[model samples]
Target: MQYYYGNQMPLRLLDEAEFWKHQEAEHTEVIREALNGLEPEYVQALKEWEQALTETHQQVVSYVETVNRMGYTFEELQEQVTELIKYCLDESLKFIDLCREIEANSAAAKDNPFAKTLLNHIIRESEYFVGIARIILYGHTPA
Candidate 1:
């Protein structure tokens, strides 16, 4: 996706990834219904996801200020961005783990296909951000 930077994001997957990541709001109903009969813990997991995502967003905003207005040295900016990336990765991994727990044994499995599909979509999005972080840390861009 043009909105994401990563070392291994395949060109063909860009549009699909963009649709899922950037346009997720359009499919809220589908997601909502998918969890209709699921265990409430799944709902709680999603709440955690929201919190994690919000925290990551805030970190990014703060880091942007540091880079733009605070006049951070290049190394300082790099360190800050790296910290932000680590925070995002840590939070995303936690959410994914929670999803796996819910998926393993819950009412969410009632519609197994839908539940798995939704989980996969979320996992892919998280992976994309992690990829960007890893690429940046390695000091290179995709070719």
Candidate 2:
């Protein structure tokens, strides 16, 4: 006797390639502008975070290359890729939180026109980054 289950929902694997492409195409320019408008300290923080991200990306690439050269099994490579994605997602969330903190503090700081403008830009940018972070972590595209 065959046990019947209700209508099965097709599981969609996270398409990291498509996600990255979309982010690069649609969000990079805004992020760049926001980074440009940040205060010095915030800029430094972003730079450091970006450096870490770059290193993580390089590590992933190296792992994939090594796996290809050394003839690792698909499962082993998938596991490594999953770990790298998790690490990058964690780092992205940390950067998002840092950006939020910077935005909040900047907004609360003394109000000079220039300072307010800068802070507003940071606030906007932080919100966007937070959305991106959520998308990366949860695999649900931001609306």
36-140, model 1: which lDDT tens digit per residue?
A: 676665665565555555555554555555445655555444454556555655655565576566667777564588778886786666566556545544544
- In order, the Cα lDDT scores of the candidates are 0.52, 0.47
TM-score of 1: 0.65
Most accurate candidate by lDDT: 1
Which regions of candidate 2 are displaced past 4 Å? 1-37, 107-143
Count steric clashes of candidate 1. Answer: 0
- Candidate with the greatest TM-score versus the true structure: 1
Each prediction's TM-score versus the true structure: 0.65, 0.50
Per-residue C-alpha lDDT of model 2 across residues 1-143, encoded as one tens digit per residue: 11131111000112342233233223223443544345666656655665665565556556645654786654555555555556655654565566456655653334445544654554455455445445534656556
Q: What is the lDDT of candidate 1?
A: 0.52
Residue 102 CA error for candidate 1 (Å)? 2.5
